[model samples]
Target: METDYAIIGGGVVGLSVAWGLLRRGKSVTVLDGDDGSFRASRGNFGLVWVQSKGMNQPRYAEWSQQSAAIWAEFADELGDATGHPVPLEQKGGYDFHFSEETLQARIEDYETLKAKIGGNYPYEVLGHNALRKEEPHIGPKVVGAILHHQDGHANPLKLLTALAADVRRMGGQVIVGKIVIEVSKPDSFRITCADSTTYGANKVVLSAGLGASKLGPAMGFKAPIRPQRGQVLITEKLPKLINRPSLIARQVDEGGIQIGATNEEVGHDDRVTQPGLSGLAAEAISAYPALARAQLVRSWGALRILSPDGLPIYQESADMPGAYLVTCHSGITLAAAHARLLPDWLEGTGAAPDLEVFSETRFAVS
Candidate 1:
C-alpha cells in the first residue's frame, strides 16, 4: 500500500508521530514488531519528569519542559477522542535526598543550568521539615528534596492505548507484529518486512527504539543507540501513602506505590536480579518507611534506548532524503512533544522547533 509516511516501529515514538501527522491529513502506516520484541513502553516507571534532566544541555531541559507544558492539553485531546483519560499529575515531582551534601551539589548544578536556560527552571529546595509537611509519610532519613514544578507522572499504559485508538480512529493504519527488514529509496521509498510484505511511501521514519541500531545504517543514519536495563517494582494497591513521585518511588493512580527503576548497563539483558530488587526495596523503605510493610506485588525489567549522550536524536538522513531517525529513552516524558510538536520538524514547516542541538550530527567523530 502507498502512504504519505511509512513509520517503522509502532511504539510510542512512532505512534505519536503517526498520530500527529494523521491529524494534519497525512496518510500513514505503522509497522510494529512481533510479541517477542522488547517493549519498554509496557514496563516503564510512568514518570513525566523534568528535574535532573538536561543538566549539561539546557536545550534538552527546555525540550522536556516544552513537552511537560503541553502534556495536559495533549492528554485531554486524546481523552476527548478515545474516551480514555490519560491520568497525569503535574503538581510537581521530587528528587529526594538522603544527605545535605548531595542535595546542595545538585542545586548548584541546577543553578548553573538554570542560568544557561535563561532562568526558566522552576524548582525549590525543601528542607526536611518542609518536605515532611508536603509528605507526612516521608521518613526521617530523607534529609531534603528538590521539587521541580514542571516534573510529574502519568498512566503510561492509558496514554499508549489512547494514542493507538485515536490514531486508528483518524484513519491511520497500524500493522502489528510486522518487523521491517529493509527500506530503500529509488524514487519514493520502499519498505520490505521480514515476511516479504512491502509498503510504499513518500517518506519514512525509523523510530524503532533499540531496533534502530541495526536498521539505521542502511537508511543513512548513524543510529548510535544502545540498551540499558531498568528494573522496576510495584506494590499491592492500598490507601495513599505517598503524595508525589520521586526518583525513588511514586504512588500510581491505581493506589499502588510504584517503586522502581534501577538503571544498569547490562547491554540488552532485561532480567531482574535479586540484588537489584533488594537495593530498590531498601531505598524505598528508607525513603517512605511505610513501604517496608507494604506487600510487594509485581516486579519486572525493561530495556531503555539511549544515545551516547543520553539525549534524543532527531536526524534526517544525509544520504537518503525523506528518511528520518527519531529515538530517545524518555518516551513517556516526551510523548506529548512527539505527538504535538515533532511533526512540524518532520514536515519541514516554518513553525518547526529549532532541534539542531538534538541532531545526530553532534555525535560525528571529529
Candidate 2:
C-alpha cells in the first residue's frame, strides 16, 4: 500500500504540509510519534508573527509576509472543513521596547530589511503616549512599540486540531505512535517504525521537528538542527489588557493572558525553571503593570526546532532524490505557506517556489 507522500512528523509542520498535499488530491499518510515525543506544536507561543523575523535574510522575511497575506483565507478554509473555528486576530501585533536604544537599533535593522524588500515592510513606531492610547493598560516602564501591520496570532491548538481533522476528512491517513526508526530507498521509499510496521510511499517528507537531527543523516541530509528551550507562562482569564500580541504576551481569545517565551540555550531540557518563569513574569509585569495582580495560571517550557542560521531548511536528499526535508522554527507563522503553497514545490510542478537559498547547500563547507 504505497501512498503518494509519507510525512514523518504529525506536528504543525507536517500536518500543515499534509493538509496542502491532500487538497491537491494526493494520497498522504502522516506518521506521528508517541505522546512521549517532545512536541513543539502543542507547546508554542501561538503567535502568527512576522515582525523581527528574517532580520539577516530578506527572502525569509518575504516568505513570512507571503504567508501572513493568505492566513485569513487559510484559517477560514480550515474552519469550514473541520467545523472548529481557528480563532485568529490579525488586526496587528507589537514589539514592545523597554528602552530607547534597543528600539532604535531594531528599527535600523528593519529599515535595512525594508529597503531590501523594496519597502514592503509595513510597520509603525509608536511612542509611549501613542502606545498608551492603543493599550490603556500599558505600564509606564515600556517606552514604545513597533506595530507591524501583518503581525497577529491564532489559537495554535485549534489550528493543529483543525488541520488534523481536515487531513483525515480529505482521505489522508494519520498513524499515531509510529516512531519511524529507519528510512530506506530500496525502490520506493520504505519507512520502518519502531513497532515493526512498514509503510511505503513514492516520496518522503521528514518534518520530524527536533527529531530530524537523528533521522536526517541516514537519508542524506545535513540536518544541522538543534534545540533551544523557550519557557512560557499564562495568566488567568482577565479583561482585555493587551490589544495586540507581542513576544512578551497576548490576551488569548479564551481570556487568558498568554505570556511567554524566554529564549534559553538549555539543550533539550524543556522544564520550567524558577529563574526563567520569574524573568518572564517580571518582563510581562514591566510591560503591563496590571499583570502584577493577574493570577498566574500555568507555566511551561518547549524546545524550538532551530537550524544553524535560524531559517527554515527545505532540501531534497542528494542520495535519495525523492526524499525531502522540511523543518523550521516558525511553524505557526509559516503554516499558511506550507498548506497553501509548499505542495507545488514538493510536486516539482515547475511553478515551484525558488527555494534554492533554503537548500542544505547553503551549509556546505566553503
Candidate 3:
C-alpha cells in the first residue's frame, strides 16, 4: 500500500513527526538505518531545556518555550496511549556558576535576551546563599545560578519507546535495518532501500540527522548539517542529591547522576578520550563537591547534529514540492512541538506556525 508520507529517518525527530502525521490520518512509513548509523537520540542528555538557547536569536528561544509549555500534555497523551510512563520534572533547571564574574556575565546576557523576547523569559539569579537554601547539597564553590522556570528534563529512552509504540499502534509502518538508497519523485515519491526494497508515498520528510547531508540535496534541500562530538559520563544510582538539572549534571529518573558532554568539534569522531572524560569529571566535581566520592559507572560519546548558526532548519524542498527537511540538535526539547504543532505546518493548515525564520535561506552557500 502506498503511504501518505515517507519519513527517511526513524529517530526522535522523524518519529515525532510521524506520530503527528498519523494523528492527522496520514499514513506514514519510517525507514530507519541499521545499527551502524550514528543514533544521537539514544545518547542525548535528556534535557527539555530553554537556557542558553537563542541567546542570539530570540525566535529560537520562543520556539523552545513553546515546546516546553506543551510538553506535559504531550507526555500525558503518549503515556495514556502506550502505557509507558515518561518521567518528567519541569519545576525549574539551573545554570550553575562557579564564580561571581561568570554568573554576572550570564545574567547580563539573559536580561538582554529577555528584552528582545518582550520580557517573557522567566529566570532569577540566586546568590550562593539563596541557592544553598534551595539546594542544601550545593557546593560552596558554586557562586550562584540562573533558575529558568521553563527548563526541565525527562527520560529520553522512555519517550523514544512511547513514541515508537504509539506510532505503530496508530498503524504507522516502521521499517528498520534498511539503508535508504534513493528518493525520486515524478507524480508521487519513490524511495528505494539498499536491499532493493521500494516504497511509494505522496510526500516525504528528510529528518535523518547528519545523514541528511547526503539525502537532502537529492530532494532539493541545502541540508548543511554537521556533527559535533559530546562526551558524557554517568555515576552509580544514588539517593536524591541534585535538586535540578543543569548543564553540568542532573539526577536522572533512574537515579543515576548524569554528567556530561564535552563539546568537541572533532569532525564525526564519537570516541571518548581520557582528557575529555577528565575535564567533564573535574567540572562536575567542582559544581557539586560531593560527586568526587561517587564511583564512576559509565562513559560515552555521541555526536550532536548542528546547523550553521545552531538553529533548527525547517524548510520545504523548493525543487520537490512535496518534500520537507526537518533537522535540529535539540530533538528532545523540540519533540513536543514536532509531534503536536509541526503537523499543521506540514499539512498546510491555517494554524501552521510561522517557521520562516528556521528555513535554509539563512545558510551561506559555498
Candidate 4:
C-alpha cells in the first residue's frame, strides 16, 4: 500500500512522530520489527528529566525543555482522544548526591549550562535538612540533591499505549512484525519486508531505534548508534518512599519503588548482570535506607540507543531528499518534541525548530 510517510520503527519515538504527522493530515504507516526488537520503553526509568542534560550542548537542553514544557498538554490531548489518561508528575525531580563535594561540583556544571541557555535553567540545591523536609523517608547517607523544576516521571506503559491507540484512531497504520529488509526510492520509496511484503511511501523516516545502526548507512546516514544496557529493579508496592525521581530511583504511580539503571558499555548484551543489580541495590539502599527492607518484585534490562555524543541525530539524507534519520537516547523525555514540534522540521515549515546542531556532521570519521 502507498502512504505519505513510512516510519521504520513503531517504538515510542516512531509512534510519536507518526502520531504528529497524522495530526497534520498526512497518511502514515509504521513498520515495526518482530517481538524481539529491543524496545527502550520496556525498561525506561519513566523520567521526564531536564537537569544535567545538554551539559556540553545547550541546544539539547533547550530542546528538552521545550518538550517537557508541553508534555502535560500533549498527554492530555492523547488522553482525551483515547480515554487512557497518562499518569505523569512534573512536581520536580532530584539528583541525589551522597557527598558534599560531588553536590557542589554538579551545581557548578549546571550553573555553566544554565548561563549558556539564557539563564532559564530552574533548579535549587537542597541541603540535607531541606531534602529531609521534602522527603521524610530520606536516609542519612543522602547528603543533598539538585531539585530541577523541569524533571519528573510517568507511567511509560500508559504513555505508549495512549500514543499507539490515538495513532490508530487518527487513521495512522501501525503494522507490527513487518521487518523491513530493504528500502529504495525510484519514484516513491519502496520498502521490502522480510515477510515478503512491500510498502510504498512518498517519504521515509528511520526511527527504528537500534535497528537504525544497520539500516541507516544504506540510506546515506552515518547512523553511528550503539546500544548501552541498563538494568532496573522494581520493589513491591509499598507506602510512598521516594517523593521524586532521580537517576537512582523513583516511586512509581502504582506505589512500587523503581530503582535502576546501571550504565554499562556491555555491547548488545541486555541480560541482567548480578554484579550490576547488586551495585544498583547498594546505591539505592544508601539513598533511601528504607529500600533495604523492601521486597524485590521484578527486574529487567533494556538497551538505550546512543550516538557518539549522546545527543540526538536528526538528519535528512543528502542523496535521498525525502529520507530522514531520527534517533535519540532520551526518547521519553523528547517524545513531546517528536510528536508536536518535529513534524514542522520534517515538513520544512516556517515554524521548524532549529535542529542543525544534532546533524550527523557533528561526528567526524576516524
Candidate 5:
C-alpha cells in the first residue's frame, strides 16, 4: 500500500513535517540521508531567533513569529511523548551592535518592518549600561542590543533525537541511507533511490536540504539555493556568565557558551578554518570579556541551505502537482510551524496558510 506522504530528507525540516502529518492521522515515511550527507541540523547555533529576520519580507517575519509563539508547547509535547528533555529558554534574546550608527540604522529598518507587520514585534533597545544591568559580564565595546522577546535557544541534537523517536511512536516509518535521485508521479508518486530502492506514496515532500537542487528541476522547481559556510565555536562548560543569546554567542543548556557563526560564501566547504575560528573568538570575547579566559572545547563549520532571497521555499510542483519542495535556512526556528500548521497547507484544508508569497514564481524560471 502506498503511504500518504513520502518525505525526502530526514533532517529537522523533513521530520517536523512528518511529525505534523502523522499527528493528522496520515501515513508517512521519511527517507533520511546517510552519514556522508551534509547535515546542517547538527551544526547550527541552535537559536530560535526572530530579530533581524525578514527586514524585507514582512510575511517571513510573521511566519517566524508564529513558530516562536508556540515553540514551548511544541517542545513540551515532544518531550512528553519521547521522554527526552529538550531544554529551551525563551525569556528573550538579543541582536548586539558594537557601533551606535549600526544600532540606530537597524532600529530604523526594524521600524519599517514593524509597520509592515502590524507592530507585533516585541523588542526593547537597551543601552550598554542598561544591558550591563541585565548582563554584568557585557564588555565595554558593546554599544547596545535590541532584545527581541520572542527569541530563544535549544539543544538541537536532543530535539532531533526526540523527533525521530516520536515520529516512530506515531507509526511513521523512517528509512535511512537512501539517497533519493529521482521522483515520478504516476497514479501515485514513485521515489527512486540512488541504489535502485523504490518507495511509493500518494504525495511527496522534497525537503532534502542541499540535495533538493539535483532533483527539484526534474520535478518542476528552479531550486536556486546555495550553501553558505558558518564556522562556530564552543567553550568548556562554565558557570553562568551570559544571560541571553545573540548572533554572537549564547550559553547552551549544557553549560558551555556557544559562540560563532561566521557567514562565509564558501561553496559546500563545511570545514573550519583558523581565520574563521579566530574571528569568532575575537567577536565573542569583545562581547563578553570573561570569555577571554574560557578554554576552547570544539569548533566546526556547517553549510547553511539558503535560497536566493534568504527566504524559505514552500511550493508544490506545477507539473507534478502532488510533489512539494520545502527548504529553509531557519529549520530550528520554523520547526513549530512546520510540525503544527504546515500540514493544513499540504492537505488543502480550509485552515491552510496563505503561502503564495513563498512560491518559486518569485524567482525567474529559466
Candidate 6:
C-alpha cells in the first residue's frame, strides 16, 4: 500500500503521531510487531507526570509542560471519537518526600528551573499536615510533597484503545503482526516486512519503542536507546485512598491503588521479581497506611524505552531525508504534543516547534 507516511510501531507514541498526520488529511499506514514485542504501553504507571523531569535540561521541562497543558483537550477529543472516555485527572500530582532534607533540596532545584523557564514552573511544597488536609489517608511517615500543577494521571490503556480506534475511523491503515525488517528510500520509501509484504510511503517514522535500536542505525540514526525494566503492582478495587498521584502510588479511576515502578537495569528482561513487588508494597504502605488492607490483584513488569540522556529524540535521518525517528520514555505524558504538534516537525513546515535540542547530534562524540 502507498501512503504519505508508514509508521513502524502501533504503540501510543506511533499511534499518536499517526493520529495527528491523519487529522492533517494525510494517508498513513501503521505496521506493528507481533505479540512477542516488548510493549511498554501495556504496562506503565499511567502518570502524566511533569515533576522531577528536565532537572538538568529546562527545555525538556518546557516541552512537558506544553504537552500537559493540552492533555485534557486531547483526551476529550479522543473520547468523543472512540466512545471510550480516557479517564484523566489533571488537578495536580505530588512528589512525596519522606525526609525534610530531600523535599527542601527538590524545592531548590525547582527554583533554578523556574528561573530558567522565565518563572513559568508552577509548584508548591505542602507540609505533612497540609498534605494530610488534602489527602486524609496520608500516613505519618510521609513528610511533605511538591505538587506541580501540570502533573496528573490517566487511564493509559483506555487512551491507547481510543487512539487506535480513532486512527482507524480517520481511514488510517493499522496493520498488525507485520515486523518491518528493512527500510530503504528508493525514490519513494519502501518498507520490507518479514512476511515479504512491501509497503511504500513518502515518509517513514521509526517509533518502534525498544525495537528502534535495531532499525535506527540503518536509517542514519544513533538511536542509542535501551530498555530498562520497571515492575509494578495493582491492588483490588476499594474505597479511594489516594486523592492525587505520587511517584510511589495512585488510586486509579476504578478505585484500585496502582503501586509501582522499580527502575531496574535488567536489560530487556521484563520479568517481575519478588524483591521488586515487595519493595513497591512497602513504599506504598509507608505512603498510605490504608493500602495495607487492600488486596493485591495484579503485578507486572515492562521495559521502558530510554535514550542515554533520558530525553525524547526527534530527528530526521541525514542520509535519507524523509525518514524520521521519534522515541521517548514518557509516551503517555507526551501523547498530546505528539498528536497535536509533532506533525509539523515531521512535515518540515515553518510551523514546526523548535526541536533542535532533541536531535541525535546532541549525542555525537567529541
Cα lDDT computed for each candidate against the true fold: 0.93, 0.94, 0.94, 0.93, 0.95, 0.94
Clash pairs for candidate 3: none
Q: Write down the lDDT that model 3 would get.
A: 0.94
Instruction: Provide C-alpha RMSD values for all models, in order.
Output: 0.7, 0.7, 1.0, 0.8, 0.9, 0.7
Off by over 4 Å in 3: 364-366
Q: Is candidate 3 or candidate 5 better by lDDT?
A: 5
Look at candidate 5 and tell me the lDDT of residue 332: 98
The estimated TM-scores of all candidates read: 0.99, 0.99, 0.98, 0.99, 0.99, 0.99
lDDT of 4 at 43: 76
lDDT of 1 by residue, 242-323 (tens): 8889989999999998898898999989999999999999999999998899999989999999999999999999989999
**How many clashes would you count in candidate 4?**
0
Mind giving the per-residue lDDT tens digits that candidate 4 earns over 117-183? Answer: 8899999999999999999988898999999999988889999999999999999999999888899
Going through the candidates in order, what is the number of backbone clashes in each? 0, 0, 0, 0, 0, 0
Query: Where does candidate 4 clash, by residue pair?
Result: none
Candidate 5 per-residue lDDT over residues 1-366, each given as its tens digit: 689999999999999999999999999999998999999999998999899889888899999999999999999999999999789999899999999999999999989999999989999999999999999999999999999999999999999999999999999999999999889887889999999999999999999999998989999988889999999999999999989999899999989999989999989999999999999999999999899999999999999999999999999999999999999999999999999999999999999988899999999757
- Residue 122's C-alpha lDDT in candidate 1? 93
Off by over 4 Å in 2: none
Model 5 residue 158 CA deviation in Å: 0.7
Clashes of 1: 0
Instruction: Give the range of the ten consecutive residues with the poorest summed lDDT in model 1.
Output: 49-58
lDDT at residue 342 of model 6 (Cα atoms): 98
Q: What does the lDDT read for residue 79 in candidate 2? A: 99
